[model samples]
Target: MCEACSSATRGFLAAGDCEGLTSLVEEVEFTSHWSYEDDSNNDSTNASNDSVRNRSMVETRVPRYWSWHQQSGEGSFVPSPDLNGWMLTIDAQNLSVGYHYRLCLDVDGVGTMQGYGYTGVKAFVSPVKATDVDLPLPRARDAELQLSCPLGPSGASAFLATSCDTTLPATTRVTSLGEVRTASVPVLSAGSASACSVMLDTAHLPGGRHFTLCVGVAGSGASLGMIGLPALGDALVKVYVTPISAFTSPRGHGVVLLGQNEKLFITCSRCTGSSEVFISSGACFVGLASANSSFKSTPTFASLLLGSSSQWEAVLDTSAMPAGQAYRLCVDLDGHIDSTLGPGDSGQFVRISGVLAVSATGLAASRVTVPLQCSGCSTSTAAYLSSSCSVGPLDVISGPLRDAPVSMALDGMGGFTVTPGISGLELFRHYDLCVDLDGIGTVSESFFSGHSVFLSGLLQVLGFSTVFKAPAQPISLSCSGCIDTSKAYLGLSCGGAGGFAAALGATAKAAPTTVIRTSGTSELLSVDAALLDAGKHYVLCWQQYEQCGPGMV
Candidate 1:
């Protein structure tokens, strides 16, 4: 038997945050303190051993005999190593979590029951789970991600590991740097053991790869420990690393031309964040390639949309940009995402070099440098077109795509060259090229004959890409004092010696063509538009003659 520590020491937490403890005790009224050597011989004053009864706490004694719910049961009352009080453990006891518990102690003395202490005050004991983890694990790359975690007293250091397969190892012990990916610096060690949040550096993580989160203390190996996640953890626990920035459309390199008021639609992937596009002076062959390279003081921000977790798209209105001048265009990520952590190494985006050739005087030799751009289209969709080559409204009667939808594939830059020669535009033809993108939108434009309409468009105005013949281009030549030759005309050819394609246009050389001119006053020739192949350089040739009879009279 043991003495009573206090007559009224109830209402105290019997055990704080107990673990692996189970018990079921009967609820009885607090009346008197009595101890018995035998239930039949209960004389409260003549109790057990006087030596042990004098001590309030008997460390050597293990309290085992007790009744639960007025029934016989076995349990133990021992000092707790983690808390400042005693903990209760029992066998053949039924208890559930989240339920408050109260335990009373009765000991076996002299081979019989002995009532020790009847605490007048009430007490409580709580069963708590050990450690836990939280979720909605965010996707990150080369940036700082704020997170919350429950890290009690023994503070821990957060660690990150990457995996392409998205499969975490069965065991949590990760020793190698390759396995752990990267880790260092303590986490949530700011104070005593507590439930707190922490920050994770999402750097040095490969893009498009899966990652695992972990925490450890005083250990070389970082163990994977996200244990408190909710059900359906498959979607919540899987974390991925995104690229800093990359060009998804217009490819990574090339030349893309744009007309005035036409937009250059760009799509990019940046794990860090968004960015603004700038039009620099002239096209830089080495954009962002050279650190010394500078950009225009002013920048033209494009209309951007975070299309998905992997890609974002933008469209720039070139109306503010000066026409006829080539400008370096590039997509940047550092401009948007916070890069406090080192961005590892690379994050190259889109860069193009090309001329903005707009002509009110018309292309020399009737050849226009056409720059075509397309957006909101899949990589396989295309466009069908037929034109008379005039930079005007689409001629539905002349367009072949009127009956059914057609598709075409544009170059990486969504550009097409318009010239008269091979890989060039046709002489003069009007076209209505149309594309029905992913069934979500349409992207199509027309550039038939004399009216050269090259579309550098986005979304509903754009589609896939393809190479087609150049639309027709009309030309008119003039001279104040010149000779009118009935055999004069216009022709095209690849860049070479004398190897020319046939002439295409209505001219003096054309059969039964009418020529309007006044000898020695003015000479004017109007050539009709004609279709030519796409993506070629053609040399223009003009045929004209004059007969100077013996006029020196």
Candidate 2:
């Protein structure tokens, strides 16, 4: 079997390098960064100025071509642009009607991944994706890792081998009696996935994070890993063996939005012995000036719909859960168990960033926030946020904004603050207090969010505690190394010595930067047409609107 697969391929290198665990191979998809090639590489199918538009200008972008088989016996794929990546089919020379073959992305990371190891945590029948959290092994309990071959026939005895030392095939080591695990398990049927779970003797296994699990099927002798697809590669999985037992799923990017119901599938392998399963929630975060106390919901018992015991699924009906409030997920096994999910972190929770309402009433723009949850969305769905009031440039106040003593002064200690004499400050926008101090002349120094003269910093900052709710918003000054250096507010039109004028000069871009990478004034070169007022003809050019100044012109 090894010779047949070896003859079909050579030098199959894996992609990506995990930071610490160097022995194991990552099982996720290699990222597919896609962009259309220029005219030199165009296949006549390309269109001129082809622009793909979704609902809004935000939240959507083009996708890459999917690669179903970068390494195959003889494969071909039709370009699947709509799917965000290319889609392809593998035409293996050795694939029979009733045999299990390991399919993979070929390499790892973004470098050159080609295949997926026929591996997943042996918890669900569908082989759920592995979590970044290390599979915690209690001092006494044994954890299970799966070895599978979906393209293989029945009666193929499978063996599992885990190792701390890399560079050697566990299948080869097992064949040579090199202390690799060799076990045989039953096969379900033809064309059915032949899977076996080899228990790890925790005592014999080195008690640390970095380890790799290798598997093989015994046919005419044993083939390391899966057959056919990955060519001659072994089914290797990276394991982070830890003394700290933990809940694995729902660990990363727990985005919870408002007006959405979330169902979480909770599983804990070390949690099998407990008779009853319970789920609990708690406020997971608190920042400065937060009044809310640490909150933990009473653990509510849940009836398990499925699972042996440890691997039970607890459905979280978070319909009534507070939006925009991050909450930690807990197993609630204090009285029932001897082991606790020690310092179980946000891997057990979700973050909400949904804004319920944003308004600019009078001189204050108020914001209401909730969760930014996703329903039926995978963790790969990315999110972007820019906190500000106007999409255009700061509405430079023209009029003497207010005729009162809204004086801004360099206090004796160089402290920057906004007191409650709030006059006609813009509502619901973020404003950087542009200032001119001694050495640094006219730089954006102090920044305050949530309703200030520059319409307060931001309406409501995402992932922050309830904003410092007050009439005069507190402006957190970030003037580094500044100590009362003749400060003057730039163009704010307050009774303070600050005033906005033409000296507030040319930024890289003009008012309302329209370009994405708005690095300079050239971004607004988007204008195309100009007509002559005399006969409404296309104007050739325009002369300078003003005369030169002094000798610098």
Candidate 3:
């Protein structure tokens, strides 16, 4: 008795490399593995005669194809009764077929009959072994990687791992091994897709390492993995057939999208009156005169018919599109009808751009452009367009805009202003007196002597507390350092002669401050004021410094 198969033949191999598998030998002979041609070299004439006679003799000994002969003693070599033409057969009565014969052709063989009987009889079936066909595993990839196992009729589960070997952490998905795994389970709705609990985190596996997958019966309690066909492969691309009349919608009333960019434009001439179209995925929508167009009721917006020719041009911004991917184009019409309407005519239809090929993934435009129109199938009861508005490119204002005054100053100190008048001058002098300054320009304490002075309380200024409330921080002055150095410095000064002086001195002591004196001109400035502490305020005054040259400065 011979055990035809053992566990050794079932051992797995790393994907892509099948090194030790056996090959099938079809013809069998128990003779010297040599030819008579060798002896011919020694004697030409003799060898030729010998060869012809030997060939004739060999042909006579060999029976016609499929002929049978007796074994050594009483046993016979009869063809198999179950099949014919090179059929492996046996003839016996009450003879128990003890062991199975191992036949190796392309791969290791295992099927061996046990029970044997007379001709035209059945034999005991042998234990069937899983045939290990040489199936090349897919090459591992950096992105999505899939390993498949053919489970024949039985469904299987396969573990997807980062490593070629199955030892590491992996994900398992059930698949029919040999053929398509047709599932009668509940349909996988929009959001419910079975996912493998095992995660293939590339970070865990060493880069460039190879992995092997196990193909085992699902729920078989085996460590090996099962297999299934890809969900996104050929089977998934089934042509979903639907009757054209199923979409009975009105013509010209719908939304249109162009290009992969999915830029949706208005179909109605009255842009403002046109319903705000929210284009999504590959759907288009228009108006329909049905009472229930929403999937639920008998009448639905599905009745709207957006015709083929009527399309709103969609100018997609390709810069915003992804590269090299397929996009679906769909349309839908959300019905928002006025109560005054009855069963109507102005029908809306979802419009889709003609079938187009997006060469590149990112933002793309269509070669053939289309004009757009909408449904005006005005019904007596339905509210039709009384008036409409058209829109164009928006108008925008430019140039410098005036802003509220932020900070004002007269000289190098913190100060307040005096309106242009005699009393204003007196009031200014009074404030100056309180500040203990001589006059607006002098910075002496005498001019502020008679003014009503108040400490104003200590307040949090920029970064420090001060007796007087800090005036608004100085506005910044825009200046290009590359321009006339003198003019840029002048541009930075926030009014006071001392302020300009300090700025010019700090910027370039050698570059004189003669040019930036815009005393009379009402100038706007943005100051950094890093020179002043946050909350601190100082005594102030204003003085006429350098006057602008005659007409302008």
Q: Count the backbone clashes (under 3 Å) in each candidate.
A: 60, 49, 80
lDDT of 2 by residue, 1-553 (tens): 1221222222221122112112333232343444533443443444444323211232323343222222223233334544444433443333222123333322232334343342221111111122333333322224454444454422333233454222333233333233344333332343335554445544333332234443323333322222322111223444434322334323223332333333344454433323222222332212210233223332334334363553544444344443333455544332233333222222344433232221211122232111221222122111111222211122222232321212223223423222223234322222222211111112111111212222221222123222121222222221111222112211111211122222134222112111121222111112212211222211111011121000000
Report the C-alpha lDDT of model 1 over 1-553, residue by residue, as the tens digit.
Answer: 1243222221111221222223434432234444433332444555565434443532333443322332113354555554456544443124222112334454331223344332433221112112222222233432443343332413344445543112232223343364236543344433444434445555445443445554433322222111111110011223334343444333112223332333344443443333444445433212332333333313334455545554444454343332222344433344423333211212222222222332211222223233344333344333333333222222332232233233333446645332222122231122233322232232222322112232110111012222134222322334322234432233232111111122332222222123456444333334332344345433223322221110000
Question: Looking at model 3, which ten-residue stretch has the lowest summed lDDT?
Answer: 377-386
For model 1, the superposed segments whose C-alpha errors exceed 4 Å read 1-200, 206-209, 213-236, 240-434, 437-553
Relative to the true structure, how large is the alpha-carbon lDDT of every model?
A: 0.32, 0.28, 0.22
Assess candidate 3 and give its TM-score to the true structure.
Answer: 0.14
Q: Judged by lDDT relative to the true structure, which candidate is superior, 1 or 2? A: 1
Estimate candidate 1's alpha-carbon lDDT, on a 0 to 1 scale. 0.32
Q: Say which candidate scores most in TM-score.
A: 2
Q: Top model by lDDT, which number?
A: 1
lDDT of residue 510 for candidate 2: 16
Candidate 1 vs candidate 3: the lDDT winner is: 1
Model 1 Cα displacement at 484 (Å)?
23
Compute each candidate's TM-score over C-alphas. Answer: 0.22, 0.23, 0.14
